[model samples]
Target: MSRTPQAQTRTQTRKVRAAEPPLDVAAWRPAPFLPRSDARDPALIFVIAVLCFLACLTTLFVIAGDRAAGGWAAQLTGEATVIVRASGGETPDAAAARAAEALAGVPGVAEARALEREKAYELVRPWLGDVSDLDDLPVPRLVAVTLDRETPATGEQLTGALKAQGLDAVVDDHSVWLDDIRRAAGVVRWTGAGIFLLIAVAAGAVVAFATRAGLAARRDVVEVLHLAGAEDGYIARLFQLRFAGVAAVAGAVGAAGAALLGALLRLVGGGEGITPALPIAWIDLLAVLPCPLLAAGVAAVAARLTATRLIRDL
Candidate 1:
């Protein structure tokens, strides 16, 4: 049907308005260059989180173990034992008492005490069978010597003092056990450090692989961005931000899990950690706090390097 001039003009005006884009297009925010999330994101998070959890736990264990070793070594270093044997007309009890008195007068000796007769008997009971009479067993008496921590007496010093007193005694300073503990602590520390480094490397490698996959999958988008005049560094920055965010989330989850387990160890094991060998403190949880930041930093560097290299090829 033929319309009037005014009606025709109104219809044409409506058509033009509908065909043109909205004025709000100028204010529209650009979406992220990369997809907000992906089907593989959760898997990546899980892998990274697990790695971080192991790393953090290793750190806590090493700290606790190292501390326990130090405490044991210190205790052993500050103490010694003297075995006194009766000679001539001396009785076991009298000999022990004389040895204790001589040791107490030593310059570095802190406190010297002669153990009771029953205590001495208990020491030899396993060797002597179930004998009710242990007094006639001819067992050597032991004098416990507590040395001053600042100037602890050595085996040689104790032996010389006993010799000068004209007593038959042997000093055991426990240097052998102390050396073993220190060596074990050193081994444990180095081993833990190696494991931590390995985990970190694995995390970085995963992020790098993810970056390559992401670039390959979104190759078309990357080409378009380059065609739109985006620089290589700019493109790389996008990926860096993406992986860093993922790593940060994963790190937080892993750190939390590790810290929770540590707390449980502290509670369940009482003064010690999961075992008497490991005595974890509440302060150890603080070590996990930086896990998220470390993970993010690693991921960011990995992603940036991978993206930059791949982008150059494109």
Candidate 2:
């Protein structure tokens, strides 16, 4: 009983339709990147941990350096030292009295006091070593002056004003010390920047390696999917989603650990003053908190790109 031509054609069409692969309904549905329970590979976890630790250290160093520099600058600013050269056989006390009396009348002077002999000795002791028996030593009279907060004087103007008086006084404005502080702060900031750049590069390399490993592990599955006519995008997405999940989990853990360490360091209290050692202000912490998210985003993007390119080659 040979079938009619129309019946044969209809049968052949049905057979062809049946032989074709089923539409990937799973792929069409939102394929969420589910993280593997075993995704926390030891090497990858270690790398993330190290990067987080370095970042946290860098944060602490920058904060501490800035605080120290600011404190030093504040203490030194608006203050001046007047050193009076004495006439022959004139005692420092007599010269200091003359200088103090003259400075007291200066319009911008807020408080002027002749540094006591003991204070002068103490100041020089660090550098000159203890010179307790200084009765024969002819050190100039030192007067410490603090300016009114509203009436700051420039270094040159203050120096000229002091010299104009017959007191033979020289003013030291401490600019050199402030300049040193500024340089130190700059060095610390640049060092931290270098460390951060290295961390970023290392992170990218780690992500690339992880993506490659994942692809190799699932090579057979990928081949089977390709044989069944799965689109390249579909296969690449599976890898991308997996890596993104892993990166997110790692980022959270790394960030939390970094925060905890920062808090602990702050509690120890070894800074210049009573403040915490590494006092990261709330705003600073908020600013730094996004770093981990940024790192994770980079990792995810890198993984996606690497996977797509690798699959195309395969």
Candidate 3:
């Protein structure tokens, strides 16, 4: 039979196509076992982000509060005050001046000076304001004392020095105040740590719950994949990666929110965070950088554990 050249080429092409091995379409275009989008994803992200935001804020608060406590402790550690009472017809001013001189000579004392009468009155007026003869009463005067940072003088030493000079004075080295500050700082640190840990645990629990829900919702797909020889680990990893990505996005959003709030505090407070107690800084915002990573890690661990357990049971 006679045939055209085009017919011969088409016949040759069909023969070559028939001779080729079957293509593994799956290997070439492998789809994810888990769907990329889920209705619960947005809610989970929001919850995780809120937790991260709280954790980051707690960190900043601890830093600022600790710094403030340290500053206050330092001031008290390097200073003392003296109450000088006049005796033997000596005037209040004279008594204070004499006490100051004696304190100045003590070892570890940096400087001492008599506080003005008005300032001394201001200190006592709060407690004795109700007294009828407040002004007429022989109010004790104050001697301002500065101590060396390394070898600061003790209250006893200041008192002894005053006694040696025949002056009546009581020294207050602010030990009580220092102790209070130390205790407060410790409490703040411990409380902040506890809160941060709580937030992390909450985030993990959320991730675990979501993973369980996802596994339950797609039980059919999971079973098919399991029957088709997908290892439990491989199945678990899909969920782990999926939830980790969601958590990471949530963490970023939360961290950004916290950082912006912190920045606003810094800007408004102007070096002290709107109060002398907290002194937020621009560098503090850097603390949030690791939040997303931390969130992802936590979510990954939680999802992996949950998914692996559920898959094995099935």
Candidate 4:
């Protein structure tokens, strides 16, 4: 009597397994992590390298911009502005002179400069359209006071002292503005961190997908190795090494491109508010050096995990 279909299928499977030679596990030299001739397609490598380079450069620019903005804020701290409103009959010149004298005697005051009428007019021109009737407009006398860096005066103390001198004085410590700037800087930093994380994830995903495709393409070779009793670890190592190599090359290219872009941007002069100031500290660049190595390491580990899991089921 003829065997059942399931039994016939099992017999055929056994015969096919038996026909395959026991792989000389020791002689089964796994391919190195380096790209095989078929896998070293320049177009694919170039595309990956360009993506990595742009991502790294964008991250560097954001980090550098934040540092430069922070430095600007620190350099301007501890400064105060004293605005003296013009009395009904008082001339701005007279009010400014009196304010300067009172401020000169104040302790911790480093320098005091009364803004010129023309300078003040120019400042308000942006909003007022034109300053033709300067004398009619009741513009206050502004005294810009720079305090000693070591002993900066608080806004309250300065205002109290000025009020005692019989002048209606308003002291602005710029705390609100500074706080806004700091908060903006924090937002930029966090955004940059998020971008870096996204790029890392993208890189890992690309590497993982490429590795999986390469493994699938070489499924026949893997089957022969499996039939010969080669361990899963040995097969996985070959793919891991190849992915590591690709990641390393891509990372190096990306880093170099970032450095070059940074240099070019620095060479271009920063004209007013159009261009951002560049922070080109050696320590800052050094901090980013590990990014590429980390990318390569992550890619290799991801590839290894993916390969081993797939091979185990086979």
Candidate 5:
């Protein structure tokens, strides 16, 4: 019991060190249920991302198609065209001008004007390519006819009236052609919706399959956890969180890929035909922003359900 001052100091230091608790590795570290490799696998993420990409693309198409169809239908339904062919004794322009005058006085006719020569040339330039003798090509004259609210002048009636005025004109009601376009747009919108649904289902199935396989792969560990009084919900939550994280990242990547592809399409198409630049709107951005969250939620629900059912059976 007798010690020197230096020895006493050393003894006290040793006591203090001994009184401190030992490092607890288990408390500091979390239980490793799912392997990091399984959680980090890029294959599942890539697959999910691809599915989300397709879903996003179809969604864009659906939105754009609906808007375009409605706009076209509205514009075309109230318009008509009168084409005056060149006659032996008179030019198409003369006949078209005369026809326009006749249409101006007709009931329900709002406005009628012969299309300018330059405008007509521009319209035909796409088909004829670069041509110098465009005027000499005997191109028919075009008259744009706008309809009033009380449209009583039918295409046939306008045509007959022009014929009586010694102008060889044919009337084209845009309503007829636009009706077919609207039908086609409807088909496209429905098709896009169907494709989007299919993609979402496929994504869900993939998540479900992955979750089931993971459960089977780690059955022994799961059973040990179960034996240790770990609740089924606790175990299920692990998988749900892991898969949900994976799906969120994958869905984001997929949405970006879809946006890139859509940009490419709009660039290549040059805002022509059915492919046009998506209009900048809050609704469009809002529609796309939830994709990752939705995918993650779906994955979480699927994983949770699958894990719970399988664990219960075991």
Candidate 6:
């Protein structure tokens, strides 16, 4: 059908406008880089929080264990115990008094004192539970010996000297038990470091996975941006910002929760036993305070790398 000149002109105008583009590429604002589907994934944040929590705990435990090991090493190094036993109708008290005198005269012995019978009984009461027949026990007299600071004597030397003096006694330098404790502490420290490394890797994996998923879901948009000359850095920056924000919030929550738990444990335990052994220095608090920031940095780097790689591949 033939149309009027004005009608033909209107139809031509509509066709040209339709063929040009749906929206202006130069002027139109890009939709939110992070879509609702990816942003609303609560599981990612929860997983990050859990990992951060465990990491915080592992860090604290490692620090505390290291401090405890040092404390034990320092306290046990210069100390020795001498046990004086009764022999051939001689009382333990007489034997202990003689041994204490002999130890005092020894070259490297700083001081030696025999523990009184009542004190010895009190020491055993914690394990034996207030026995009425404590006097029936064949407990040897305990002589607490302090070694000289400059010339500390070894257990063998001390034993030989005491024996030469005709004293019935044995010396315990506490080295055997201390070495075991130090070894165990070293194992714990290494184990904790391994766990912390694993957790950090897991956190990075989570962020990378989320970035890949987001990139996959928005492939068409990314293709448009790529065609429109959007650089990889720009795209990566978007992902970095989004993921870092999420990670920072989640890590803060997790770290805060762990710190509260630690505080509660210390409160309930009354700073006795294990609680007192933990590292309570201000530096420890400083170390823990930046955990959230560290997590956020990890997430940001992970997201940036993942997004850049995926975009380059595309």
TM-scores of the candidates are 0.88, 0.78, 0.88, 0.81, 0.68, 0.77
> Across residues 106-207, which tens digit of lDDT does each residue of candidate 5 receive?
777889999988888888889999998886787888999988756546777777778788787789888677878879888987898789878878888899
Ranking of candidates on TM-score, top first: 1, 3, 4, 2, 6, 5
Best model per lDDT: 1
lDDT of each: 0.93, 0.73, 0.91, 0.75, 0.82, 0.84
User: Which regions of candidate 3 are displaced past 4 Å?
Assistant: 1-28, 130-133
Per-residue lDDT for 74-136 in model 4, tens only?
765768888888675778878877787787677888887787877777777798886578778
Backbone clash pairs for candidate 2 read: none
Candidate 2, which segments miss by more than 4 Å at Cα? 1-35, 39-43, 104-108, 224-234, 270-288
Residue-level lDDT of model 2, residues 1-314, one tens digit each, is 99899999999999999999999976786533334555447668667667766776677668767877777777678788888778766777988877777776777778778988877767767877766686677767789988776776666665666666666678887888989888887898899889888887788778888888878877777787789998888877776666666666666667677666666555554333226434455444444576667677777787888888888878
Badly placed stretches (over 4 Å) of model 6 are 1-32, 35-38, 87-89, 118-139, 148-151, 273-283
Model 3 Cα lDDT, one tens digit per residue, 1-314 = 99999999999999999999989887796666777888888899889999999999999899889989999999999999998999999999999988888888999999999999888777788988655556687889998899999998888888789889998888899999999999999999999999998999999999999999999988999989878998999999999999999999999999999999999999998968858899887888899999999999999999999999999898
Which lDDT value does model 3 have at 227?
Answer: 83
Pitting candidate 4 against candidate 5, the one with the higher lDDT is 5
Q: Report the poorest 10 consecutive residues by lDDT, candidate 1.
A: 128-137
Screening candidate 6 with a backbone cut-off below 3 angstroms (N, C-alpha, C), the clashing residue pairs are none
Question: What is the model-wide C-alpha lDDT for candidate 3?
Answer: 0.91
Error of 2 at 131 (Å): 3.3
lDDT of 6 by residue, 132-249 (tens): 9888788789899998877887888889878987887889999997998799898989999899889989999999999998899889989989999999899989999889988988
TM-score winner between 3 and 5, please give it: 3
For model 6, state the Cα shift of residue 36 in Å.
Answer: 10
Better of 1 and 5 by lDDT: 1
Report residue 94 deviation for candidate 4 (angstroms). Answer: 1.9
Model 1 over residues 1-314: C-alpha lDDT tens digits?
88999999999999999999878976889877788899999999999999999999999999999989998998999999889999998998999999999999998899999988788789888887899876666889999999999988778888998999899999989999999999999999999999999999999999999999999998999999989999999999999999999999999999999999999989999887777689899998999999999999999999999999999998
**Segments of candidate 4 deviating more than 4 angstroms:** 1-36, 270-288
